[model samples]
Target chain A: MSGYHIAIVGATGAVGSKMMEMLEEATFPIESVTLLASKRSAGKVKNFKGMELVIEETTPDSFEGIDIALFSAGGGISKQFAPEAVKRGAVVIDNTSAYRMDLNVPLVVPEVNEEALRTHQGIIANPNCSTIQMMVALEPIRKKYGLKRIIVSTYQAVSGAGISAIKEMEDQAQHMLNKEGYEANILPCSGDQKHFPIAFNALPQIDVFSDAGYTYEEWKMMNETKKIMADETIKVAATCVRIPVVSGHSESIYFEVEDELATVFGIQQELMIAPGVVLQDDPDTQTYPTPLTAVGKKETFVGRIRKDLDEDKGFHMWVVSDNLLKGAAWNSIQIAESLHKLDLVKI
Target chain B: MSGYHIAIVGATGAVGSKMMEMLEEATFPIESVTLLASKRSAGKVKNFKGMELVIEETTPDSFEGIDIALFSAGGGISKQFAPEAVKRGAVVIDNTSAYRMDLNVPLVVPEVNEEALRTHQGIIANPNCSTIQMMVALEPIRKKYGLKRIIVSTYQAVSGAGISAIKEMEDQAQHMLNKEGYEANILPCSGDQKHFPIAFNALPQIDVFSDAGYTYEEWKMMNETKKIMADETIKVAATCVRIPVVSGHSESIYFEVEDELATVFGIQQELMIAPGVVLQDDPDTQTYPTPLTAVGKKETFVGRIRKDLDEDKGFHMWVVSDNLLKGAAWNSIQIAESLHKLDLVKI
Candidate 1:
C-alpha cells in the first residue's frame, strides 16, 4: 500500500478521465501512474496532479509491471485486456459490463459491499451507475428492516452514456431552439441499432432489449442487486429511463420489507446515520433531493420518504446521486482504498 | 351548433394559448371568440381565425352571452368564475382542480368517457394531464380486459406547470452551462415555499406533499383516473416526477388485468386500433415515443409494451402525449365536439 504502480485503462474516455481526477484528489500512494487507451487516443496528454501524462496505446505487454489497473473502456476492450492485466499479476478494477455478472468476479460498491472485496481474485467489477447509487441509499434500510422486494424507476443522466451523449444533447437542444433538424446518434444506447434525441425528452430504453423483454440496463440492476446483497430471495424489478440531465441519477423506489412494523420515520432515521448518505426529507421546509443540486457532490441524497397507503410493510423514497462520482470513479477509488485497508491488494 | 359564441379564460397562459390554437384548427363554427384574462393581461391582443381578439378582464359578467367558456386558470379563479359562467347558461369546461372530484361535476376525457358529458349540468372537469394521457392509452385495454390495478411513474415536462417553468428551465440550464448563479423560482411547485432548478435534473415532488404521502400531482392522477374510468374498484398509485423536458408528458405504467392470458402482442394490437392512440412499439426499428417527437402532435403515443416476467396478469407500457394538446386543448375541443354530437350544447 505504500508505493504501487497503477495503470488507468481507457484514459481518454469520460469515466476514465474522472478516475484520473479522483485519484489526484485522493492523492493515492502511487510509485508510477500509466495512462492507457486505444491506438486512436494514444499520445493525448492528460493532466494528473502537477504532471501531464501522455496516454499510451493499450496492449497485452502494457501491464508488465503495473500493480493495479483500472479499466473504464468498453466491454470489448475490457474482455480483451482485463485478463491480460490479471495474468501479469495486476489487480484489475473493471468499470465495464464484461465481468460484472461473472460468477468469479466480485461486483463491488464500496459503501454497500466493501466486504465483498475480500474475495476478489484479481479483478473486481463495478456495478451500473444507476444501481450503485440506489444500493448506496437503500443498503442502510435493507440492513435495518430486512429488504424483501424492490421496484425502481430510474431517471438517469446523459453522462452515464459518455461525453459524446452530453454533447449530442447540447447540440440537439440548440438545433431545436434554432428550428433546425439534428440527427440523434448516441442515445438511448450507443451500441444499439438506432439513436433517439434525449434533449427535453425521456427514452424508456436505456439499453438494447433482450429476449425476455427487459432492457440490458434493467437486467443489470436486477442481477447486480442480487449479487451485491448476496440474497437470492429478494425480488427486484427496474425500469431504466434516460433523461436529459448531465450528472445525477434519480430513482423512485418502492420497497417492501419483511418487517411490517418499519415506518417512514424509522427508514429516515436509518438513512440519517448511513455513511455517504444525506437525508433531505423535510416536507414543511419543502426539502427534497434533486439531481440539479446533487451534481458534483459525492453523497447519495435520499428524501420524499413516505409509507404506502395500501401496503402495510411498504415505503417509497426518492434517491439522487452524482453518477460520475459515487456511481463510477469515486466508488472505484473507494474500492481501491478498501482493498488497501483489508490488505487484499498485493504488490 | 351553428355560429356559437365562445370565451377562453386564462388566455395568456400555456394551456390557454394551446386551447386557442386548437379552436382555430378545429374551426368550430364560431360566431365570435372572446379572450379573457386577469387585469395584467387584459389589454393584450390574440389572433384567432384571421381576426384580432382583445383580451378582456375576467369577471362575473364576462360570460353573459357566451355559449361555452374554457377555463385554464388556477383553482381559485375556476371556483370563483365557473358558477358565474354556468349561471349565465353557458357550459363550462374547467381545466383546474377546483371541482374535479366534486361528485357532481362530470370529469371527462373525450376518448374515455365522452358519455359522461351527456350528464353534465353546467361545469365539466378536465382530468390532470398525466391522467388524461394514461386514460387514453389504457381505456381500450380496460374495455378489452378489465383492469384491476395501475402503477405509474411520470417523466413530466416543465411546460405542464406553465410558461414560467419552461423559462426557468431554459434560464437555469444556460446559467449552469455559463457557470453563473441563478435563482430557481418556478419549479417543483410554483406555489410551494421553495423552488429547485429543473434544468439537467429531475424533481420527484411535482406539487406539495399531501397527508397521504403522495404529491398533489400524484393524488390528482389517482383520483382523476378513478373518476374518468368510472371504476371505484380500480386501485391506482402514482409517482409523478418533473423533468427538464418542455412539452410532452411521458409515463411508465404497470397495470394488472382481470384477463391473465393476454399477451404483449394482443395488447399492442388493441392499442394500434384504439381511437386517439398510435402504437410505436417496434424494438427492432428503435422507434419509440418521446416528448420532443410528440410536440405539436395530437395523438397519444403508446409503446414499449411487455409482459411482467413473474406476473401473468401484469403488463407494462410507455405512454407519451403532448400535454398541451391531447392533455388540455384537444381534449377540451373534443369535449366540445362530443357536446355538439350529443345535442347537449344549448346555443
Candidate 2:
C-alpha cells in the first residue's frame, strides 16, 4: 500500500498542535503533511518527521490531493471549509460541534463506534471532549450489563476553552495568591457575554445556555451519547463544570444497569480488559486517578467504583483523562487510522 | 429573659473562629463567653463582642455554669468532651462526626429540620459541610414533592479540612504556578496515610475509605441526609471531592421527586421563599453561584435548576455555600437559636 496525504486545519490552536504531536506518535504511513491555519499563522514553520513544513492559509484549494483532513478550528471554519474539503474528495474528520448532530454525519468515538465510520458521508464528526471520554468509559459497561441511565458531573480543566483561557487562569491565580485583583475576560465561555475567573474556583456553566436551562455543553453530552451509542433509549443527564486544572477532565458518574444482577465486581472485570481504558481503583492502598495523575495520557482512567447502598443495580465511578489528548487530538487520529484500516478512503 | 453563659471548645480552630464571628453577627444575648482549646493554645487571647477572653485548656470542668457549648474540635476531642458537657447540664452543638450518626443524637440542619433540635439529648450534631447545603436546597422541594433519590458530586474547598489545609493549598499553588516542586501533606484526608496535591487538581477522596469503598465523607452525606430528613427509604449516593478553593463548597446534585407534575419553576418557587436559600437561576444573564461568590455568606446559593431531559420526575441543580459559614458555624448558631426559641435549653 502507498502512503496517503494528510492536512490539518487550525494548526496553531491548542488541540490542533496536539493533533500534530499525536499523529507523529501514532507513526501512521504518510507521504506528505500539509499544515493549514489562519492568515496570521500562514508562514509559521512546523516540523513533521524531521522535515520543516510551512503552514499555509486554509483556502478551498488546500484539499487538492489530501486523503484525510483533520479540523480543530472553530465551528465557523468547519462549517465553511469541511464541505469544500469533502467536495474535493477528502474525508474530513471535524473536531467541532458544527457537524456532530447532523442527520447524515456520524459522530464517532473510535473505541466505542469505529464501525460508524462506514456510513459517513464524507465528514466524520468527533464527539464533544466531555462526551468522548465518557463514551469510552461507559461503553464497556453498557456492552456487558445493558445500560439504562447515567448521571454525570464534570470537573473539566481550563484548557478545553482554548490556550488563552489557560493564560487567563494562571494570571488570575497569581493575582489571587498575592491578594490583588485580576480581570476575568476569557472564561466560562469566551464567546458568551459574561466571563468568570477559573482560578481556585468552580464554574457550573461550560458552554452557552441551550434549551431547558442546560448549557450547550451539557446538551451535547446528552444528545451525542444517544447518537454515538446508536441506542436512542439510553438516558443521559450531565452537569458540566469547569475547575482550575490545566489539562485533565474528571467526572463523577452514577449509572444504573438494565440488569439488576450487575455488581461492582462484574463491571470492574469488564473494564479491566476494555480497549483504551485503565482501571486504577484500589481502596486499600488509596489508589485512584486525579487530574494531576491523568494529564498527558491517552487512556481514560476509571476508579472509585462502588455499588449504591439503596439501588441494587446502581453504581458510581470516577473517570479522568487528558482533555486535549484522549478527548480531542488522539481520538481524531484514531478515527483517521480506522478509516485507513477499513479502506474507506483512497490512498 | 436574662443572657446565658456560653463556651466554645477548640476555639483556635477554623470553624471555631467562624463560630465567634457568627455569634457577634447574630446579636444573640450572651452574659459571658469562654474560649477553650488544647493545652498548646491555652494562653491565647480571642475577642468576642468587644470583650477579651483567655483560652483555657478544655477540661471536663470547663462546662461549669455554661448554658450552651459549641464544639468544633477533632472527632476525638468531641467524643471525649461532648459527653462531659452534656453531663454537666450544657447543651452541646457538635461540629464533628463523633455523635452525628448516634441514634441518641439528632443531626440537624436548621433550614430542613429545626424541629429535630427539640429532641436533642443534650447534644445536637451539625451535618457534614457538603451535606448541609444540599439539604437546604432539596428539603424545600422535598417538603412539597416527596424525594425518592439523591446523587451528589461535591466540589469542596480546602477550608473544610482546617486552616492549615488552606495554607498548604496556597503554598502548593504558588509552587505549581512557578513550575517548582511542592508537597502534599494535608489534603484529601490528613488522617489517611496518603496525600495528594489539590492545587490545580481534583481529588476524588474526601475522607478515609469506609465500607463498600465509599469515603467517610461520602458516607456522611448519604447517612446524614437520611437521618436529618427522617426518611430511611429514600436512596442516596454521593461522590465527595476536594478542589483548591479556599472557602465555599459546591455540589452538583441530581434528585428524583415523587410528584411527576413538579416543574423547574415549581422547584424554584419553593427555593425563592425557602429559609436560608438564595435563588440565582437566570440563564439569560448567565447568573449562578460560584465558590468565590458564596464565600463568607450565611445562605445556601442555588441555581442552574433544570428538569431531566429523559425522566419526568428527575431534576438537576447546582448548590453552593460557605463551608465554614452555613455548612458549619452558621448552622451551629442557627441550631442554638432554635433551642432558645423552643425553650429546650435552660438559662
Candidate 3:
C-alpha cells in the first residue's frame, strides 16, 4: 500500500466530496486519505470508495505528515490555511481565489498549462470553474491559430456557489410553483450585500461588485484567464451571470484569432481532437451542448461554431461543462496528477 | 369616437392578446376595433375595453375599412396577409420576422428609430424580442457617443415562443419536481427538428440554425439591429439562447463606442432621461432588474453599466424587458402611434 498520503480540507462540502469521488475513480494511488473539515463538521462520517472516513477538524498541525492538501472550503479558509499547509512542506492545490493572482502561486489548468506546475512554490492555485473550462477549450486553438481577444457571457450554475445555494435555488423554485412567495438569502454571491432569487431568473452579478462595477467573479475570469495563459497581450472582457441551473455552467464566447485564414471548419477540427474537449456541434442534426446534458461530464463541450458575419477574424461558440467536476474537483485532481507526472510532488 | 378603425390580427395569441391589452390601456383613438384570427380560431369572443369582439376568419377583405392592422400570428401569416391588408388600404405593423429584411419594409424599434416609420411602404416590422430591448438601451448611447461594435448574449424567455411554449416550460418543471420524466415539444424552436427540455436548463439555439451556422433568431438580432438602427457599419454579433423563464428576455451587451472619452457615469446619465429607458443600476443598493421583476413591464430596464478595464471604448450593460411587451406588443402599438402622429396611416 505504498502511495502518496493526501489530505482533503473541506471534505464535507459539495466540491470536496466530488474531489474525493474523482480521486477514487481516477485511482490516484493514495496510500492514505485524510478527510478534514471545520469544527462543526469535524465529527461527521462520510463514505468514500466503500469505506467510512471520519472528518477531522482542521488545524495548522493537520498537515504535519501530509504529502498533498486539497483546499475548497472558501477563499477565506484557503487564505488562512493554505500558507500554514505550505509551511509544513505539503503541496497545496487550492480551489479558491485566495492565491490565484499571487505572482508566486502557479495557477494551473493542467490541460492548458501543466508546465506552470513545475514552477509552483508549494502551492498551485486552481483557476475559477468558468476559466478552467474555457482555457481547456481555447488552448488548442490558441496553440495553432494564435489567440487575440475574447468576449464571453456566462450562464453559470448555482452549484458553483456551494451546496447550500443549490438547495436554495431548488426550494425557491418549489415555493414559487406552489404559489408561495420565496425567500432568498444566498444567491448572486452570498457575500454580497444583496440576495436575489435565482429560481427562474438570471442574475448578472456572480460575485460582489467592486467599486469599478465588475463583480469579483467576473474579474476572476478576466484576470485568471490571462495568468493561466501567460499572455497579458490578449484582450479579455466577461459578463458572468447566474442562471437557474444546478450543475453545468455554459458560456457564449465570441473570440478573435490572430490567424487571418482561420475557418470555422478548421476551428471545429481542432476542438474535435483537443484534449478534454467534446465537440457536439451539428446544427442539422440538432446537436449542441446544454447544461442538462453536460451535468455529470468532466469534459468541456464546445459547439455552435460559426464565423462572425462582420468581423473576419471573429468566431462564436458555446462551451459547457460540469461546474463541480471539470470546473473544480476533477480540475484539482488533474493538477495533482500533472505534478506527479512531472516528478514535482514530494512524498 | 371619431377616430380611425383598427384591426388586430392573430388576436387570440399571446402577443396578440397583449396588443389588445396595450391598446385598451393606452386608450388608443379608435372608432372601432376588429379581431381577426385563423379559421380555427375564428368565432371565438374576446373582451376588449369591456366590449366583446368576435374573432373573424382572416381574409384578403378583412381589412376593407381598417386604418391600422397589427399582425403577430406567425411569419407565414404575416407573409400571406400583410400585402392583402396593405392592398385593402390598411397600414400593417407586423410583429413577425417575415419582411424585416425587405428593402421596402422599415424595421423599427419605435423608441430607437421612430423616424424610420416615415419611409415604411404600407408595412413596418418589429425587431426580435432580444434585439428590441438592446436597441432601446444602446440607441441613446449610440446617439450621444456613436456606436462602433456590439456583441450581445441573450437569455430569452419561453413565452417568446408563444403561450403554448410557456405552458410547456411550466409543465416540464412540474414533472421534474415530481420525479417524473417529461417530454419537450416546443422549445429552442418549434420548427427545429429536435426539442430539448428547458426546465432549469439553458438552450443555446433559439430558432433554427441557418446554413451559415447561425440560428435564424441570432441572424435576426444581428441583421435587425443594423436595419433598425440604419447603420450597417456598426458591426453586430449575437448568440441567442432560450432559458426557462416565463416572460422577460435579458441580454448582456458589450459595445464599443466611437467616442473614446465616454464614461460609465455619462452613459448612465443618458439612460436616466432616455425615453422608454429605466435606469435600475444602483450597485450599492443591489437594484438591478431580473426577469421576474421585469415581467409585465413595458419599459426597457438597463443596469450593471461598467467600463472595460483594458478597452477604453468598450462598455458593458444588462438590459431586460418583457419579451411580449416592449419586444413585441408595445413596440407594434408604438409604431402605429408614431404613424398616426406623422399622418402616415391610410384608410
Candidate 4:
C-alpha cells in the first residue's frame, strides 16, 4: 500500500476509538495502522478496513517506524510519550494539553491555522475540543471583521471527560428516574475532590479550579484560543460548564469586532461559507442547532446569530458540535490530512 | 379574619402549587384563599392552613371581594381577566407576561424594585422566571457600581415552560435511556410550531422567537431589566436555553460597570449584603451554586464571580434559583407583601 504509516496511542479510550472509526470512514489512505494503549487494554482486537488489529502496550519504541502518531490518552500519557514519539522521527498529533502551551509545538486547527503545521517540531498540538469548534465557527468572521474580544459560556457534555463519565451520567440519570440514589464518582472531573451528579443538573466547574477562579477547562478555552489564533491581543474569557449532554458541546458566545461596520447578516454569510461550519440560524422559521442535532457530526453548527442591541460591533451566537467527532477524533485526522496534503509528513 | 383576601389563579400549575406552598410557609396574613383555575380544574380541592378550598372556575366574577389576586396562568388568561380582577377592587400581581411591558403596569422584582409597586395602576407584573433571578443577583451591583451593560446566557429548567413541559422532559429522558423513540411536544414553547426534546439536550429557543432574532423570553429579559431598574440607558441582552433540569434556572452573566474601580471582591461584598441574594463563591474551596443545590430555594444564589481579564470595568458571575420560587411564586407573594407594607393595596 502506497500510503502513510499511522499509529494511534490510547486506541481503546473514547477519543481513541473514534479516531479508529475516522480512519476507517474517511478517505485517508493508510498503508498500515498500529493500535496502542496501556498494558491492560493490550491484546484487545479492533477491525480497520477488513483487517483485525490487536491493541498493543504503548512503549517508547512504538513509534520507531511510524510516520504519524495520534495521542489522546491523557495529559500524563501524552507528556510521557509524545516526546518519545517525536524523538523517534514520528510527527505527533497530540490531543492533550501537554504540549499545547509549549512555545516549540504548534497548536493547529486546520480550518483556522493549517499553515501552523509546517513549523511543527515533530509535535503538533490539537487545540482543546471547545476551542476547536469555536475556532471553526469564528475564524471566518475573524478574517473578515478583525476579531476583538470574546466571552463564552459553554454547555459541555459528559463524554468530554471520557467513557467512564458517560456511563456515570447514564447510571445517575437512570437512578434518579427510578427514584433511587446513585453515587457520583466520575462527573464534573474525576480527579477533582468533589463529585457532583450530572443527571438533570448543571455543574459550574469543569476540570478543577485553577488560576483566577477559572477552571482548567475554562483556561484551556481562553489560552488555547489565543495560541491557535496566534493573536494574544484578542481578549477572550470563558466559563466552562458541564451539562447532562452525552456527546455534543454547546456554547453561547458573545464577541466584538474591530470593525464597527460588522452586521449580523455579514457574519452569517461568513459562517455560511466557512470550512467545517454549518449555519442553522433562521429564528422566524424556528431553525437553530441543539446538542442532539449536532451529535455524531464533524461540522460545527452555528445559530442564534443576532447583533447585540446596544453595541454595533458586538454580536451573539450559539455554536454546537459533536465533542468526540469534530472536537477530537476528526480534528486530529484533519491535521494528519493537512500534513499529508502539504507534503510535510516524511514516510 | 382581619387580613387581606387573596385569590390564586392557575392554582393547579407548577408555579401555582409553589404559590400555595409559599403562602402556607410564610407569615403573610391572609383572611381567605381562593383557588381559581380553568373550568376543567375547578372541581379539584386543595388544603391551605388546614382548611379545604374548592377551586372555583376563573370568571369575571371570581375576583369579587378579593383584596389581592396572584395570576400565574397563561398570558391569554391574564389578559382576559386581569382587568376584571382590577375592576372588582383587587390588586393583580400577574405572573404572566401579558402586561409586563405595559406602560401602566409596574414590572417588579421586590428585592430590586419594590418601590415600583407604589405607582402600579391596579396591576403589577412579575418578570420572566429567568429575568427575576437575574435582577435579584444584579440589582445590588447595579446600585453600588453603576451597571452599564449586561450579556447573559441561561441554562433554564423545563418547569419554566409549565407542568406539561416538565412531564415531557421526564418521559423523553426515560425513553432515551431505554433506547426507545420519544416524541417531543410542549417544549421550547408549547404554542410554537415545533418542539424539541429537552432530555439531556439544550434547546436555545424559549417562548418563541420575536424581534431581532431574539426569543420573546430574551426580549422580556432585555426590556424588563431596564424597566425594573428605571433606567432606559442600561444595555441588556440574553439567550434563554432550556435544559432537562426539573426546577432551578442557572445564568452565566457578563456585565460591565461604569465604575472602573469595581473589583470582584467589591461585587461579592455587594451581593453578600444584597437582599434575596446568597453569595456562594469560594473557588479555592470548590464552592459554587448548581441547579440541584438551588432547587426549592426562594433566594437567588450567586457564585463563580470573577473579574474580566481584559476590561477593568467588566465582571462575570453565575446565578441560580428555583424558577418556580424566586422566579415566580415567591416573587409574586413578595410583591403582595410590599403592597401591604406600602399601603398600596386597598380593600
Candidate 5:
C-alpha cells in the first residue's frame, strides 16, 4: 500500500480541502498526491506536509496513474469523470449524489456498511452529510436493540451548503445589523429557483421536493437508513432543516426498538462503547453536545437521552457532529481506510 | 367597554413591553394605564401613548381600581399577584405557566380556544409560546381534518427566554468574533446549574428536565396541546431547541389526521384560509416562512406542506410565528378582546 498515487477532485472546494487535511492527518503513504479542480482553481497551491502542490485542471486524463480518486465535485462532474478514473484503473470514491442509490455502487458509512466497499463496481458513494452522522450514532443502538422506527429532525450547519453559503450567512447577518438588505443567493439550495437568507433563520427545505413530497434530503435519510442498516422493514421519517450554525449538524432523534424497554442510561452506556461515538448526556450538570463545541471534532457526540413519556419502548436523543469531519471528509477517509484493511482497493 | 382602566404587571419584562406596544395598537378604549413591576423597577418610567407611566410595586393594593390587568411576569409573580387582582374585581390575563394546566383556570389562544375565555374565573392563563404558535397552525387543520397525533421539533429564538438572553446571544457572537471568552448565564435554562453559549449553537434543552426526562418546554407542549384542544386522546411529542435567532419560533410539525388522502396543496389552501395563519409555501419560488421574516408578524406562518411518505393519513408543515406577538402579548390582548366580546370580563 506504500507509495500509492492519489488524485483529489474538487481540490478547491470545502469538502475537498477537508479531505486533503484528513489525508494529511492520517499520514496515508502517498507516492504522489495530485490536486485537481476546475480551470478557475488550477495553479492554486495548497500545502501538504510542508510541500506546495499546485491544483491542476480536472479532466478525463487526470487519473492516468492515480491509484485512488476522491471526488467531492458536483454530481455532473462525478458522473462525467468517475467512469474516466475507473477506466484508468483508479477506484473512485464519490462524495456526490451521482452514484449513490445506484444499484451497482455501494453507499458506504465505514462503521455501519464497511463491507459494502468490497462490492463497489467502480465508485463508492458517500451518504448525505446529515445521514452520515446519524447512521454512525444509531448503528450500535440498532445492533443492540433491534430497531423498529426512527424519527429525526436535523439542525444542519451552513457549511453543508458549501463555502458560498457560509459567506451568504455572514454577509446577511452583517447587513441585518447594518439595517441594510442583502440578497439570498446560495441557500437553501443554490440550483433551486429562488434563495432565502439563512442568517438567524431555519429553512425546512434542504433539497428539491421529490415525487413523494419529501425533500431530497429527507429521502436520502430514509433510503440510506435502509441501505446502511440493511433492513427494509425499519420505518424512518426525517425533517431536514438548515440552521444558522456554521459547522456541526445536530439532530433530535426518537426511536422505537423491538427489544424490551431500554433505559436512557443503558442507551448512553451502549453509545459510549460504540465506535466513532461519544456520549455527552448529563442533564444535572447541563452537559450536552452542541455545534460550537463539536466544531473541528471528529466524533459524533450524543446527549439528552431520555425515555418517551407514553411509550416505554421509545427513547429520544440529541446527536451532534462536525459536518465537515465525521459527516464528510473523515467518513470518506474512513471508507478509504476500510478499503485498505479489507484489501478491497489495489495500488 | 369604554374608558377602562388597565394595569400591566412586570412592565419591564420582555412580554410586558410587547404587551404595552400591543395595547397602544389595539382599538380598545382605555381611560388610563398603570405600570407595575417589582420594587427594584418601581421608580422606572415606561412610555405609553405619548405619556410616561411610573412603575409601581406590584401588590394586592396595586389592583384596587384596575379594570383589567395583564401579567407577563414569572409564574411566582403571577401566582402571588393574579389572585390579588381577581380579588380586587379586576380580570387578569396571565402570561405565566402558573395556572395553564389548572382545571379551574382557562388556558387560551385567542383564535383557537377563545371560547375557553368565556369560562375564565377572573384569571386567564396564556399558553406557552411554542404551544401557542403550534396550536394556531394546527387548530385550523384539526378543525378541518381532525388531528390524531402531533410531533413537533422547535427552533425557538433566544428572546423567548427574555431580553437578557437575546443580549447574551449578541454578546456571545461578538465575543466569539473577537476571540474573547464569556460565560453563559441565561440559556438552556437560567435555573439549570450550568450554561452553554447559544451563539452558533443549538441547545436541545429549553427548560429544566422533568422526571420523565422531557424538558419542561416539551412537557408544556404535550400537556398544553391536550388542555387547549380539550381532547385528551391527541398524542403529542415535542423537542424544544433554542437557536441563536432573536424572536420568532419555527416548528417542524408532523401531524396525522382522521381523514384519508390529503395533498400538500390542499393543506396549504386550508392554512391560507385559516384565521391568524399566513401561507408562505411556494417551492418553485423558494418562498417559505423563516424566523427572520416572521419577526414582528402577528400571524403564524405555515409553509413546507407535504404528506408523510409512509403515512397516507399524515402531513408535515413548517410553522413560524413571532413568539412575542401571537405567542404571548398579542394573544393576551386577543384574549382580552374575546373576553370583552363575550361579556365575560366585569368592567
Candidate 6:
C-alpha cells in the first residue's frame, strides 16, 4: 500500500463516525479505510469522504491488512479484538478504559504525551473523554509551573454517554416540558442499576460506582491524568456530573502550582500560545467558554481564570471541549498522527 | 390588630411571593398582612389567604401598622427603606445581600446560626441561597466532627436572579431550540455590566467581579459561610455557576473535618437527625439530590456522601435546595419564626 491502511472498529458508533470525519480533515496518509462493528450492526453502511463503507463484523481476520486500528466499541470488544488486531501486526489505539492503566500499553493524549507513542508495543490507549481535554489544557501549565494538586468538578454532556443517552435527554426533556412522563433507562449508565432523568437535571454518577464510592468514570479521570502526565505524587480529585447538553464537557478546575510566582496572567499568556489550547478569558467583555459554544472543533477552550481568594498558590479556571472530538475521536486520530510524526509506526 | 402584622417589601418579587407562600405552610401567627412594592408594581393585586391585597408603593408610612417586614426587594430598595421600616417599629428581615455582612446585623442560616438572630438590631439578614443550603447540610456534621475547610462548586438556578431572569432562560432556551437567536440580558446578576445565556450551558460567573477576579457572588459564599458558621479561621472557597434550572440550587461540596475518624456513616447519621436537612445518599439506587427534584422544598437535600480518596479528613457531598424556598423566602420566614420563638419580636 502507498499509505497506511486504517481500520475503524465500531464504525456505526458516534465516536467512530467522528473518527472518520476527523480523518478527512487531518492531512494523514491513509491508503484505505475499513469499518468494523458487531454482528448485529454489521450490515450498516457509513460514508467517508465520497465513499460508502459497509461495516463488516469485527473478528480476528478484520485486521489482516490494516496498519492502524481505531477501536471505540465497548470494553468487551476492545478486550477481544484489540489483541487480535495487534497479533496481526496492526497497532490498535483503544478508546475504552480496557487498557488505559495497563503498564505495557502507552496511554497517550498526543498534545500531552506524544513521546509515549514510541514505546507502544502494538497497542496504545486513548484517555477517557474528560481526562483527554483536561490533559490538553493543563499539560503546558504543568510543564511550566509544576502541578501540586488538582480538584475538578465536571459538567459533562450526554453525548459522552453515547447516542442513546443523547436521544434519552432530548426525549425526556420534551416529555418533561410537556408535563408528561418518560422512563429514563439508558442514562447514568445503562449497566448501572438505576437510571435518572438528565433532561433539565444533573446526575452525579457518570459510570458505575466503585467500592470506594467514586464512579469508575471518576476513578478513570483521577488515575489516567496521573499516568498520562507521568506523575504519581500529584493528587487529583474529580466529581463528574452529567448535564443536559449534547456535545461539550465543561470542567471547573482548581489546581495548586508548585511555583508560587505563577500569576494568572502568566498562565494565561502561556495558554494563549500553547498547543491544543484556546484561551477565551475576558471578564470585561463577558467572554468565557461554555458547552454550547464548544460543540465542535478540536482545541480545549479555557476561561474564567482567577487566583483562589484564600490560597496564594491556588488558581481556578474553566476548561471545555467537544467531548466527542478532542476528548475521543480527534484524540485517537491525533495519536495515529503522532505515531507517524514520531516515526513510531512504520507504514 | 391582635397578632403581629407582617409586611412584604417587594411583594411582587419572586422571593417576596415565595415568602407569602411559605408563610401559608409554616405555622406562624399573622393577624394582618401588607404587601409593598415599587411605584411601578403598586396597585398590583395579589391574593393572600383568599384576600386580594393591593400592592402599595413602599414608603415610610407603609410601616406604621407593620410589626414585622420581610424585605426581598433589591439591595438599593432595602438600603433605602429597611432603616425606615425599622425606625417605624418593624423588625426588617432583609433578603438582600446589603445587610448580611453588616457586623451589627445577624447573618442567619437558621440551622447553622439561629443564635445570631438574637444579636440582630432590627434587621436580621438572610444568608445567600446557595450558602443557606450548604449550611443546613453541613452544620450537623460540623457539630459532630468539626469543620476545617470547605470548597464548593454550585449549579445555581435562574430564579435566584429574579422573575425576569427565569423568563429570560425559558425564552432563550426555546428560541435556541427552535434554532433562533435570543439576546441574554438578566442573568449572572442583572446589576453586572453584561449578561450571558444560561440555557443548556454554564456560566462560571454568578455576580459581578470583585477584586482578585472573584465574583461578588463567590465572595458572598466564601465570606457568608464563615459569618453564618461564626468561625473566622475556617477556610472556605466557592465557584458559583448559573445553570438553566428554574428553582433549586445544587452544590458539590468538599470539606475537611477536624476529626480524622469521621466516617461517611457517622456524617450521614448526624445529618439524618439534623433539622431542616434531608440525607439521600443511596448510590446503589441512583438516589441523589438534583435541582429538578428539589423545587419548592423547604429542607436542604444532601447526598453523594463519600470519603475523599486522598485526604483522610475530607469528604464529598451534593447539596440541593429550592433557592426560592429554603434559600430565600423560606430562610427569611424561618428567621421570622425564630425571632418570634425567641420572644424577640414583641409587637
TM-score of 4: 0.99
Tens-digit per-residue lDDT, A1-347, candidate 1: 46778899988888999998888766447888999998999999989889989999999999999988999989999999999999999999998899999999999988888888878889999898988988998899999989988878889999989999999998887776656888899899888888888887899899898766779998999899999999987888788899999889999888889898798888989999999999999878878898878988889999989887667787788899999989999888888878777878789
State the C-alpha lDDT per candidate.
Answer: 0.88, 0.93, 0.91, 0.92, 0.88, 0.88
Q: Tell me each candidate's i-RMS in Å.
A: 1.4, 0.6, 1.0, 0.7, 1.5, 1.5
TM-score versus the correct structure, for each prediction? 0.96, 0.99, 0.98, 0.99, 0.97, 0.97
lDDT of 2 by residue, A1-347 (tens): 67879999999999999999999977568887899999999999998878899999999999999989999999999999999999999999999999999999999999999999999899999999999999999999999899999999999999999999999999999999999999999899988999988998999999899999999999999999999999999989999999999999999999989888788888889999999999999999999999999998999999999998988888999999999999999999999999988889976
Q: Kindly report which residue stretches of model 4 are placed more than 4 angstroms away from their true locations once superposed.
A: none
Model 1: CA > 4 A from native: none
Q: Is the docking of candidate 3 incorrect, acceptable, medium or high quality?
A: medium
Report the C-alpha lDDT of model 6 over B274-309, residue by residue, as the tens digit: 999888888777788888788877889999899888
Question: Each candidate: how many clashes?
Answer: 0, 0, 0, 0, 0, 0
TM-score of chain A of each: 0.98, 0.99, 0.98, 0.98, 0.98, 0.99
For model 1, which pairs clash?
A: none
* TM-score, structure 3 vs. true: 0.98
Candidate 4 structure quality by residue, lDDT tens digits, B1-347? 48899999999999999999999876657898999999999889999978989999999999999999999998999999999999999999999999999999999998888888878889999999999999999889988999999999999998988888888888999999999999997888888999888998999988888889999989999999999899999999898888889999999999999998899989999999999999999988778999999998899999999988998898999999999999999999988888888989886
Please report the candidate that would top lDDT against the real structure.
2
The DockQ assigned to candidate 4 is 0.87
Say which prediction, candidate 1 or candidate 2, comes out ahead on DockQ. Answer: 2
Q: Is candidate 1 or candidate 3 better by lDDT?
A: 3
Candidate 3 vs candidate 5, TM-score winner: 3
Predicted candidate 2 versus true structure: per-residue lDDT over B86-187, tens digit per residue: 898999999999999999899999888888887778999999999899999999999999999999999999999999999999999999999999999988
Decide which is better by DockQ, 1 or 4: 4
Per-residue accuracy of model 1 over B1-347 as CA lDDT, tens digit each: 36778899999999999999999877457888899999999889989878888999999999999999999989999999999999999999988889999988999998889999988989999888899999999999999988998878899999999998888888887776667888788778988888888887888888788875688899999889988999888988798999989999999888889997788988988898999999988878877788988889999999888887656788888899999999998898888878877878898
Ranking by DockQ: 2, 4, 3, 5, 6, 1
Reference-based lDDT, residue B40, model 2: 98
